[model samples]
Target chain A: MPTFRVELFEGRTVEQKRQFVEAITKATCESLKVEPGSVDIILVDVKKEDWATGGRLWSDAG
Target chain B: MPTFRVELFEGRTVEQKRQFVEAITKATCESLKVEPGSVDIILVDVKKEDWATGGRLWSDAG
Candidate 1:
C-alpha cells in the first residue's frame, strides 16, 4: 500500500476533508487493487507559522 | 514539532479538513512553542474497504 501525505493551504471544513479522504482512498484502492481495509489514511494539521510554502511560512506566504 | 496521524471514519469535506489542519497546527505550535513553518501536515485518504474501525472495515462499518 502507498502512503500519501498532502500539504496545502489551511481553511477547510470537515466535510471537505472527508471528501478528500474518500476520493483518494477510492483512487488508491482501485489503482492498487487492494482491499479498502488494507489502506490507512492519516490527517496532519499545520498552522501558518509552522508551515512553509515557496520558501515562506504558510501564514506569511498565504 | 510532533507529527500526528489521525485515523477516523471518512466522509468529510475539503473545507472541513482545512479547519482541522488549522486548529491542530495552532494547538501544536502553542503547545510546543515552535515556529509554524517548522511543522508539516499531511492528509491521507483510505476507501471504506481499505479502512477498518472498531474491528470492522470503515466502509462496511460506517
Candidate 2:
C-alpha cells in the first residue's frame, strides 16, 4: 500500500480534491505498477500560520 | 529532521493537539536522538465520507 500524505495551503474545493486523488491514483498505478485501490492519498490543508520556513511563517512572510 | 504525518478521525480539541505535539516531539527526540525543534508533526483530520476501506467508505461502513 502506498499511502500519500500531502500538505498544502488550504482553500481547494472538494471537486479539486476529487480530481487530485483520481489523478494521483492513476499516476501511482502507472509508475509503480500498483493497483488504484491500493493507493491511499490523505490531503492535509495547512494554515500559513501553522507552517514555517527558515524560522519564518508564511503568514508573516507576506 | 523527522517529519510525521498522522491521520485520524476528526474532532480533537486544540488542547489535545497541543499535548499531542509535545508528547510526539519528546518521543522523537528520545527515540531518534533528534532535536525537538527539528521534529515536525502534521495532523490530518479525515472525514468518514472521504476515506474508504474494502471498497466501502467509512461513512457507509455502518
Which 10 consecutive positions of candidate 1 chain B have the poorest summed lDDT?
A: B49-58
lDDT of 2: 0.78
Global lDDT of each model?
Answer: 0.65, 0.78
**Residue-wise C-alpha lDDT for candidate 2, range A1-62, written one tens digit per residue:** 98876788988766666667777777778999988778776667789999999999999996
Estimate how well candidate 1 is docked, as a DockQ score. Answer: 0.07
Candidate 1 lDDT over residue span A1-62, tens digit each: 56555554556555566677777778778888887666655444557788775788766763
* Local error of candidate 2 at residue A2 (angstroms): 0.4
Q: Which stretches of candidate 2 lie over 4 Å from their true place?
A: B1-6, B11-44, B48-62
Q: Retained native contacts per candidate, as fractions?
A: 0.05, 0.05
What are the TM-scores, per candidate, against the unseen true structure? 0.45, 0.58
Task: Please state the i-RMS of candidate 2.
Answer: 3.7
**What are the per-residue Cα lDDT tens digits for candidate 1 across B1-62?**
57776654467899989999899899989989988887778765544544332223345443
